[model samples]
Target: MTAQTTDPAAAARPRLRWLPRYDAPRLLAAQMSLIDQSFGIAMVGCSLAAIILAAGLMLSGDRPGALPWACAMVVACAIAYFGRLRLPGRLTEAGAARYAHGMTATLALIGALWGLVAWLYLDVRMPAVVICILSLIAGMSAAALAVFSACLPVAIAFFLPAIVPVWVVFLATGDVEYLPMFLGTPLYLCVLLVFARNYARVARQSIALRFENVELISQLREQTARAEAAQHAAEDASRAKSVFLASASHDLRQPLHAMGLFLVSLGRTGLDERQRQLLAHIEASSGAAREMLNSLLDFSKLEAGVVTPRARPFRLQPLLRKLENEFAPQAEARGLVYRTRDTTVTLHGDPTLVELVLRNLIANAIRYTQRGGVLVACRQRGARAAIEVWDTGIGIPAAQHRDIFREFHQLGNPERDQRKGLGLGLAIVDGLAHTMQTRVTLVSRPGRGSVFRFHMPQAWDAPEDTPRPLAAHSLDGLRVLVIDDDEAIRGAMSELLSAWRCECRTAESEEEALAALAAFTPGLVLADYRLRGHRTGQQALDAIRQQLGRHVPAIIITGDTAADRLRTAHATGTALLHKPVVPQELQAAIDTLLREAATQGKGAPDRQAAVAK
Candidate 1:
């Protein structure tokens, strides 16, 4: 079998959070180089003194015995000079052999010093003063390198055996005239001083560079950690969306899919008027299911940060009116009271996102309560205003308070709730609250209701205007143009409006709407956002207005919750009522528009008629 090997690049890759440790050989080499340079200068000083002695001996008269000894001293001086060439760079700080070679060369020079001294004492008249001065400078220089090299203390220990003899000779001699025999001793001392200073500078610079490298490495590691954390957060969010879609997919699709079948079934059956009304209720239930799914999809987008806020100065009371009308009928159906206490403060924030948050909270409160009530209230607090939703319901558990805010998490009780939702309501509230830099709080206990509250900044620069309560005009006898491509939806809406005593004219296209407009003008227009044959609600509404010679009040009712729908609706200043439209909400929207028309008297029509259309 052939041997297998790992890829070198793969092997070299850093482990997860690997920490670096000290290496012994590298430390030893650095220390040795510093010491060797110092000792090299020391040896040069001693060699110069030996050459001077040899010259002095040659000048002495009738001194035959001193000649061979003088020759031996000269040879020792030559050996010391050549040894510098053989030695490697800074002994203590170099690699293994380079450090060892420096130590060996230095030891040889020390021995040569001894040999020169021995030969001079035997047969030559050695200048004790000169030799002593030169040797002292050499010895001092060697001592400094030795001390500095103690950082790598092993190198300093190796030099000790060679240093002792030099000290002994200087102590033994006391001749005063011998000092003049060596003139270059001070110059040698200066050379050693220069080398010692240079060694210290090199060591300091190396350590500084190493520290900078480590600092840069630390910053890189920190940035990498931050990037990893962001990636993990994104993955967690994606998984949450997947799980939510998986769990609620069947429930959401079942009602919509069944309603289509039921409508087909109804057409085949020969139903009486009462039976037809019951079939209409089935259709209404299907529409409610579709609305809930659209709401879930909207919340998912907000939680993913795909939607941003479009905030401006607006009175808080109008938003409160919208919520009150939307939920009042549902509350009444359960025999629970719904109330609103509006504040007149001008606020700044994305009204659509804010309204969605409040709507979810209010709806949830109504779902949980058995026989109590829900309240929407607002109050001014310093630079901000607090929007609150209070309810008397099955209160949230203290332990599960936080978990309820997570996506697709519902309280695990067997008692079935009629108002089943995708359970992302609170999660969306949390996300939007974060983006707006607002805080949401919960106050509750078991068997007691919960109060959900958030704060909004006051628009201080808003035009001074007193806030007013919404008009109490019902949708009775108000004329409305209902334009839609779907005949069934159009008929259902017409029946619902007729029950509210509104004059409803149904149209399938712009041509149909224009034909209707020729005979009568409507007070308000409610249109399906998507019509047949590439036509849209706005085009139909516009054509009707042009024929009637007056701008018509309008709002868009749609099953589509795509970003384009939201953008176009807001851009045209039209109210968007997502389908299947809540009857009370639709009636309230028509009432608000008719009242506005009565107040403005149709002068230029605010160009906002394009909103719901």
Candidate 2:
């Protein structure tokens, strides 16, 4: 027992155990930062009040050391307060703890200084001065308890030092006059400590709830980002599918175009009735395949949002007449009447897209009607013209009207007959109408007939120059240049052009075409848009024009349904024809370009002279 040794580590543990423990370290750090920011103005205000109090005490002839002690306390408070303000906004748990402890020490020193003032300056004979100084100290202590209550340990550390010294001094005097102050100081400190403890608990809970809310918001943002990425992936896959369909269609159409030309050439070889009938059947089969491919291509383009409408003013009567002439043969072959009611009503819309809509509707009418005829008519409907297609076909039920416009949706053709088409006519019509910002309506009664109609705004201020019909021209004795990548296409075109009694020169590329131009001066150039070695028809035409030193009218034929290829061809300012080009359509395009070239040739000398100058 006499040789017992003291353990310093064990003794220090109990003293440090009195420090408060925080379960949430990060939350404690956040609370400390908030307290520092919120208390800047309060700190400055308290420092000023302390300086003024010290000056008043000095003027009243108080203890000599009181003024210097008060000034020292104010300086320390300013250092602690301003030092916290200069810290980085974010703090680590250890750093926050250090700051809290430092601030607590500084506040405790100030509180103790105030207590000293009360002890040293209170005059036993001057009751009014005693009351004034004691009251001021009590008020400051209450304010400190309220302000520092966000951190309980700091508030407790400050409160005890601020009030206990005054209480002890009053009791030690053993004077009955200061009995109330000694008793009341303890009660006031008790109430303030309880309130500060309650305030600290509430602050901790509030900070924790705010942290949880921040975490939830971060999770929501992450989920939104993932959803947007998935949507972009889906859109990319859809575009890839469209591209695949277009490429496949182009490859298939090349052979179909050659077959159509070959068939026309073979017809001139003088075949018998049976042979002609077989040839007709083959031609019909090829035509049916081409129609299906075209339908699918149209639907894909509309779905891809590449079909831009170029609206303009044009007379409706001419368009109706053109459709009638085009469809008259098929209707006559089917032993049905194709009627069109023409009017001089001018309408505003994209002529190409509007024609497409009408073409699909008229074709549908001709396909579905077996017993009766189809009627296309236009009527003025107050500021708009209503273009209607009425047919006595296998009428649709009310339930099927909406479904009929869906792709590959067929009514009464469950066998998916090729002759009945792929059921995309109405779908294309609906899509085209929607693109033009117009409405298409249907009125039908089952087993009777159906009427499809759409309204176009009237073009009241349209130009007076109406389009004239194109006159057919004979290609006889005309020199034509044919350029294509495929050998079969070149041979088929040569045979067809020869059948028209025209001199034909064939080339497979720009080099071959330019070489051919030295021997033959062609009036017209017909070239495939996609040629050998990745060269385009436009490039070949440009090279030929440079070699010739003049503009030669040209026509571009392509099987590509890709929107970019179509747009490029359209920009060339030359006639464009899609393949499996109908032999008639190809011949018509060639004739148009040749005739245009010849008309411009009349004034060629004047143009050439201008260029020379």
Candidate 3:
């Protein structure tokens, strides 16, 4: 009969819900698990209570079936406890509801059996017996509420059967003496029912909260994994890009080196005003390209550890004024103001490197800022001078504060516009800062602007070291040796050297240079680091020095930017110049090396002596 009534509805309709018939499988599973664990304890307790009640009845010698009733109830409870244990811990919604329904029916049967005491054994005329039976009925209802209240349907099911029979039996006695229990049974059931409904709602809510938290944590872990994967992939791609740039620059250096020399050579020849204007445009474009390559070379030099800072006391006013003059026109063209506050404060550092750092900072400030002005100022703090570059520009977030100093990192430049640069400005600035034993500090707020502060030690006792400006020193009748494997480069270099009125000879290999040495004892040797027959310029210089029995002044020019290559070339103890060298810089380097040779009493003693002075 129970199966016929409950099986169809169990499959078709949900018996448990926080709302109207909205079945929740997870919630049902939680409720069932709670009840399953405690059901056996509850049944054991019921069996014990039944035995106590039966013993009393037997001792009074009134109820003949008391011992048998206690035995029957205990047997039923043992069977139910074992059956409840067979139910699966994990359950489908329908299965959970059916479990609840089955438990409720089982509880009802036990409750009805207890109700039999009220029907057959109760006698209101016996006050002691009546009091004991009433107390047992109320206690059973209260226990059902406490143990099974997580599922409201089961609690109410056990409650109705146990209490209803007592009310019926007492009312039919036709005694006004039993009115209190008849009135009190419904009130007792009502209170327990309310408490059961409230406790079930709270338990369901708590379980749902736990499930939500677990789901959120799972999603957080998944997102974190994806973010880390993306970061690693981006880092790999950046490394690949750096290597490609280094290789491509190496290949283009030879041609660019030759081209720059030929352009200088061509400029010396006669040309009209219109032709001169066109030449200026070409030189301007070449200068821009060379600047980009030089940035990479500068980075390579730093990485190769070839650069050293010579700390000398120098005033900041001159450097700041020069930068102001150079960038003010640019700032004006951009419809923004540019200004500087001059300070006579002397700082002890390498002036050229300091200038380079300041120039990069100023350029970066001008590039990012669209609407507001940039200011360069200096302030004294204790024994240090703090030089600051302030810009009202698009600011960086606090999260990426340190990442901006990493190579090839840029924000808001996804298209990688060359005008915005190669993203190495701040990286170079940071590297130079570390080399100088200073930290470049930044203060920025998103959308407000930024300030970059650089500190230098102030010099008090040291004499001021002013910068020496480069002048056009004549290379007339200078003994110059130009050795290279490429014919075009050799020819172009010869023309450039001859136009400067220098006695220049060209060689293709070490053998050719050695053979030429018989007729021509050149003062200065210029060689390509990577020459024909796998011979490097360093090896050529070594061979030439071996033959001559003296240290002949030489310069090695090449485009390779590998740190290992730079370090290897630096090991030769010769002047090293990267390719695409402009005429002015090339002349300056040659003059500087020649002056050093004159001091050492080697290489064209008379002319080098004259150039040195």
- Leading candidate by lDDT: 3
Better of 1 and 2 by TM-score: 2
Positional deviation of 128 in candidate 1, in angstroms?
Answer: 7.2
TM-score of 1: 0.52
Evaluate residue 474 in candidate 1 and report its C-alpha lDDT on the 0 to 100 scale.
Answer: 78
- How far residue 402's Cα lies from its native spot in candidate 3, in Å, is 14
With a 3 Å backbone cut-off (N, CA, C), the pairs that clash in candidate 3 are none
Q: Rate the local accuracy (lDDT) of all candidates.
A: 0.64, 0.80, 0.81
Cα-based TM-score, every candidate? 0.52, 0.74, 0.63
- In each prediction, how many residue pairs overlap at the backbone (N, C-alpha, C within less than 3 A)? 22, 0, 0
Ranking by TM-score: 2, 3, 1
Better of 1 and 3 by TM-score: 3
Judge candidate 2 against the unseen true structure and give its global Cα lDDT, from 0 to 1. 0.80
Cα lDDT for residue 388, candidate 1: 92
Model 3, residue 610: what's the lDDT?
A: 13
Tens digits of lDDT, candidate 1, 441-479 = 999887988999999998887744645867667777878
Residue 9 alpha-carbon offset, candidate 2, angstroms: 16
Model 2 C-alpha lDDT per residue in residues 489-553, reported as the tens digit of each score: 99999999999999999999989999998789987788898988889988998899899998776
For model 3, the superposed segments whose C-alpha errors exceed 4 Å read 1-22, 51-64, 88-90, 117-137, 211-258, 261-281, 296-314, 321-342, 348-353, 361-377, 381-613
